[model samples]
Target chain A: MTDPRLAYVQRKTRRRLAFSAVHLVLYFSFSLNWSSWGEPLSHRLGVTQVTGSLLMFILLVLIFIGMEFLFLQMESKETQE
Target chain B: MKAMFLFLLRSAPLLVLSGVAAAAGSIDGEVEQQPLNTTAIVMFLLFVVMTLLITWRAAKTTTSSAAFYNAGGKITGLQNGAAIAGDFMSAASFLGITGLIFVGGFDGMILSLGAFAAWPLLMFMFAKRVRNLGSFTFVDVVSQRLARGQIRIVASIGTIAVVIMYLIAQMVGAGKLIQLLFGLPYEVAVITVSALVLAYVAFGGMLATTWVQIIKATLLLTGVTLIAILILARTGFSFNELLSLAVEKHPKGEAILSPGVVFKDPVQIATIQVSMLFGTLGLPHILMRLFTVPDMRQAQLSAFYASLFMGYFYLVLLVLGFGTVAFIYGNPEYFDADGKLTGGINMAAIHIASAMGGDILTGFMSAVSFATILAVVAGLTVSGAAAISHDLYAQVIKQGEPDPKTELRITRIAVFVIGLVAVVLGIAFENENVAFIAVMPMVTAASVTFPILLLSMFWSGLTTRGATYGAIAGFLSSLLLIVLGPQVWVSVIGNEQPLFPYDYPGLFTMPFAFAVIWLVSVTDRSARGEIDRANYHSLLVRSEFGEKAAGEGAVG
Candidate 1:
């Protein structure tokens, strides 16, 4: 079995990496002003503006939730160990 | 003089509340002439009644400092998430950031995005460590490996400073909101908010604060989502069309879609973003909420949930802010005779509500705004109370010998005192455009509290003297720079020249804070410094592995 302390560190490191990746995406989007792309993206995707923003929002939420669940799963494993 | 002062202080709340009632009554004729938002008033009162019931329940559960400060660590992750969101997304956010977007467009989005960026960092860096180490206050975490009494004294000073600054900002926002939505006098609004906040916090403590926050967050999220849907429906659900309509309706035309309206320089922009990022990480009330959860996992989950909710809420703000231009831009009902936006631009969200769903929806949004202000103020008061009663009175003053009864009593008295001070300052700054006041506390938190906590947690070389002096240095420098900065210097002090060129001091002072702690710790050769350095290994182990070590129960 993996050392629980080492496993905890690995899990934490993975979360940090995931967070950094998301932060990078956000930073570049805001810096390059690509956040305003939802309007055009919606038009190209043949969706309403509301749907476009909502879809984007739902996508971001899913990503965050996925990352969180992974972290929690690792935490549970550590506790079980 | 002292006796008279004591008597006046004791009767102040009653005096203020009665004065508010009389002032509210005197404006009856004018208020009657204007169309009444009776539905809004009724809904607001209903909310107040419901929250009071919650507080009454919470008061019975609050018996010890653990219960008073942390709600016995029984709050679920989701509930704590909502409460944290409530504490964060205050009236300033609902009104101020939306107003920023309505006026400055992309720049407002940038300001808001900066605020939201702090959450991911909170989850990554501080949330778990803070939850694992602290019970009641963030000071508990900082003092865990240091000298408890002295370190807490310094931490309390930082806590109360941030609290008072944040309180004044919330109070001003509440006062202005009531005046706009209910046509009440500003002083009366300030007093009314203070009274309700005091009742909840002084009686129910953290449990009530958490519930109030959770309820307000739910209401605010629901209300904003409804308005966003209405606005999108108006625009045929097209983001492009919404932007086009907003540009056409707004006086700035296509300039609204471009950045650099409010914040011009890139350095200034970066400074504000840094302030927002670390500032939220260090806010006393927000940090205090992390302790309300059961354990590190709950704390982590709470951060995740809060970030998700806030991310969605902020995106909704983007819609609400830009949608105002499409819907309410030229509406005479939302404008003054001079063609200015009524209640300044901050009423954009409310105007959008009125335009979309008429009086009932506007009333609901108005009531949510009131609840938002009240909930945030209650959160602030509880944290400020813990700083005073837990950190100052019990730990520092009484050397941790105070009984539970005395501690609880001190906490209640601190709540009253903090509420009264907030009211007085809120009323005094009524005409001062205190909207920007919210940013100051965040900057101060980033500068002072963030450095001290981060250093104490991670650095083995950091001593008690270093933490205390570093905190003082960071605290004083941030406040001093803000005073010398353009906002206070030219605007508040009516000066021709600002000593500090920047509006925000975070970029400079945050680094300086870290440097001061480094310099102080590295140079110190004292026996206490040696002991504190030696204790750092255990602190690191506990913070990293969730193991209890020495000083875990030092404060409690």
Candidate 2:
């Protein structure tokens, strides 16, 4: 964290770590919660047959693809500095 | 040693055939013969010809160790990403997972989700740094900071162990798949896949392997998309209807859409997630893909693309897996006399293809699967060969200075030997439940390679002795647990109770390794350990910035 370049990299790394944390939390919550909570994912959404299980899966895929895209964009900008 | 290796390799097939027949409950059994479908044969032949052409072109350019190891570092982000996807979509995941879904409904989705759970983290953490530090292998990055020779030897052992286990899993799956689809004998199926892999890796090396992977990924994605579309078309393109239809037909009833239908244990769920998330980072073949790209941006982009493709693929699998329940579950045609799937649950993917598109589609899927096995094993072979030649032979045996010619020669020899071993082992494990072995590499990777690589790169205080001990500790603990886990003990050994209750080893093993490395490093005050810690500064600088910061080569 001494050199300016190194400091900048650290700043970017913090953001990456944040994203990773959210990812792990979201994933573990969706996957492991069913066992302890008695099928929380089975609850249906408002007026639709689409259940929480399907919703979680879609949310995960979106987050997976979206976060990686966002990270690539941010990293590209940072490296240009 | 060579004789013993060959002897073990040669005896592998016979051992699998007998499956310890002297014992009553061993794995040895009969393989149901498949009909000789000429269409499937034609499709598979076409894939083989296409692969041979790719290898022919690649062989001409593979002159040096660099070219052989990483395709001379000229691959693009898009190409590398597809290649990474190709590597990820092994026959085991593509077929085995769908099989799980076909039987267990929403429960089988544990693996489909578990598979891609690691990617964003891998992208956010390791991708760019790995590209910046290593040339041929990930060990290059580790050796940059630690004792080069000893660490490489240690890492090379780790890599080979992971690679060999992974290779056998794919080989056995491929052999059975080939027999089931193409009506070839088990031995012929194994040899055919191995021989083609030997050609691709020995002569064409990474370039051919990468292209083949890219090609296979494209085919697999295309095939999956077609089947998904057809399935959706049947249900008027509504996922809810598909789910409803699946529920109506599935024996699990409404549980098909609910969790805990397949995996009810909290420990099992946690273990599966942990292993998939961490073990992915340590897979040698997957990690090796980062170096194939020319620079860091490409490396990051490739991971992005890989996750995109895989994510898309997995979502599509939910549809197809449910579709198998909707269409294939009650279809007695696909069932044997015992009321099981004729080729087992894995055939759900292919059976669904037939339900929608008939024999031609089934043939196309079979061919794509054949290509998937070949590309994955080819990728594994090159990485395994690199461990043998680049890390073990060059870094350790030659003290880090290797003649280009000798190294390339050794790599090619290693490729042939590895291919032979895979073919033999494939034949040997024909009747065994190779699913455990298929996932073994991921567990092994989580324990040894993943921890060492992460500590060496990120943890400033990691000394050589600490890292080595961590590896040995991680590997031994994971191995012992797996041997005692339900898969081996209760299932394979017919024991009443498993010493290790869970199959996934990462939850216990990875943290244990990190702790061991931490304790050992903190306790060490040796002079050499001080140097190892001190080297962290240069390693960090070079990894974040570049070696010289002049060109793309230096701009990582």
Candidate 3:
């Protein structure tokens, strides 16, 4: 006797968990590849390691800001619906 | 191979004697050698003036219990985000970790990176739930469906234990810094730092503390970035050259860039890494910052920013650590006449700075380090004050309408009490490896708090009895294991045998807590009906959208 409501909640939880898992794997893979490949590119680009790190940091910050805006816009759309 | 064996045999006696001397009188002599310079004196005065000014400003907004405890719930996410960075970037981040990497090499950097990796998990999992709950203590999130009284008691105990442990660590660090830079006696230094931190938080409240943290973080980042650039210039911006120089100096240098060379035991390394990563999310001081953000979105953003900043800072520390080994470690001038590395890791950063530029640069860096200690101690005091005054006093015992004015006074008193206790503990543990010992208490807090917090937010069936039992089980098990573990026994009784060979017990304790909560919740049918339909709906809505949608739905 599975409660339909509990089943629905479980389904949603599983989806969210799957999304998070994917995101985490992507992040880990990208960081590893970048650390290995990015170092030489940084040198070739005439950027010191510190300068290269700062650039990456700025990029990360912008990505987060963009995500926040996107999330907020989606919330607004949901409210209208 | 034969030469290496002879070298080890020759050095063993000196190492043994030094260890014995460190336990006896080494710290006291080190304290006497360095006195406070004019720059350090001026910086201390400046900190005092700034603290007073901020406290005065915070006094205007702190008119109620809510404002005093949580900045009136009006702080924007960006502001709160910066404060979160401030709080997380303690003396441990600035001085301790940097020193660790300088002395211990790769083992230290791994610890930092492992701790930093936990931030994303915290953001994705805990932050939104914490923000939606809008409670002062972490227990507030876990106890949403539980009896208020039960949650209050359990939460207060966990909060108190964690705050005390953290405060003691900060106090010890402050004492050590004072001894190194100011030549003050350890007892005097501990008292001075404790009193100053208490004053800042007692008067400033959350608003003042936030501003202080922001200022501290700004100064720290600026100082370190400058030092990193300077070091790069000195090395002609050649990363390979620096590495080669380090390798040439010590054949073991390459091992530093790689892992597992220092610890050797595979099991110990795995256990330690797991503990450092997961235990990070459960830290009480870190958790308290989530309550400061305006909404869930801000919470997530703030965590992302913190991780980025922390990662950048750690990379700089890698430079500083290797820079010290290359430039200052064996220099005759860096050591005292006895051939001892007289100043230890605290001097590692400034020595390199001096070598790069001159005495002027060293003075400036020292001032920055001094500011780092003050700022970190202030943040620790405020978080501890919140647990004592808000969680224990207003929510738990009083249960009366929280009068802001009276609560502020109580918070001040609480700060004083916490500061006094820290000073005493700092003095007692002056000779021990304070940073390593400090991590144990945080581990205990994380083990207890993390499982209960996670289950409560995600598991709708988490019952009151289950949470209470789970928290108690996690707290007691972790605490007992740590006390009986090698670190403590080695500190107290000179014993080498570890009860649980693992330095961190989270891998064992966290799952145990989750199991207890599940088992108890399953058995307790009475708690099945405790969930509020409206509140649960609001939580789900708030997590997905933001607070505005939840508010609109409530009105509709």
The C-alpha TM-scores of every prediction are 0.87, 0.92, 0.81
Residue pairs clashing, model 2: none
Winner by lDDT = 2
After TM-score superposition, the amount by which residue B487's alpha carbon in candidate 1 deviates from its true location, in angstroms, is: 1.0
Model 2: per-residue Cα lDDT at residue A9: 63
Question: Which pairs clash in the backbone of model 1?
Answer: A49-B237, A49-B238, A49-B239
lDDT of 2 by residue, B65-123 (tens): 89999999999999999999998886656666666677666666667777777788889
Candidate number of the best TM-score: 2
lDDT of 3 by residue, A18-38 (tens): 544643453333233124443
Candidate 1 per-residue lDDT, tens place, B247-287, comes to 78766666566664454566665676667777777888889
Ranking by TM-score: 2, 1, 3
Candidate 3 Cα outliers beyond 4 Å, as residue runs: A1-16, A19-81, B1-33, B431-436, B527-556
Of the true contacts between chains A and B, what fraction does model 2 have? 0.58
Per-residue lDDT tens digits for candidate 3, residues B155-243, read 77787787776666666666766667656667877777777676666666677777877777776677778777777777788765564
Compute the DockQ of candidate 2: 0.64
* Per-residue accuracy of model 1 over A1-81 as CA lDDT, tens digit each: 245765555556566657756764754344333334333432323532233333443454455556656666766787787
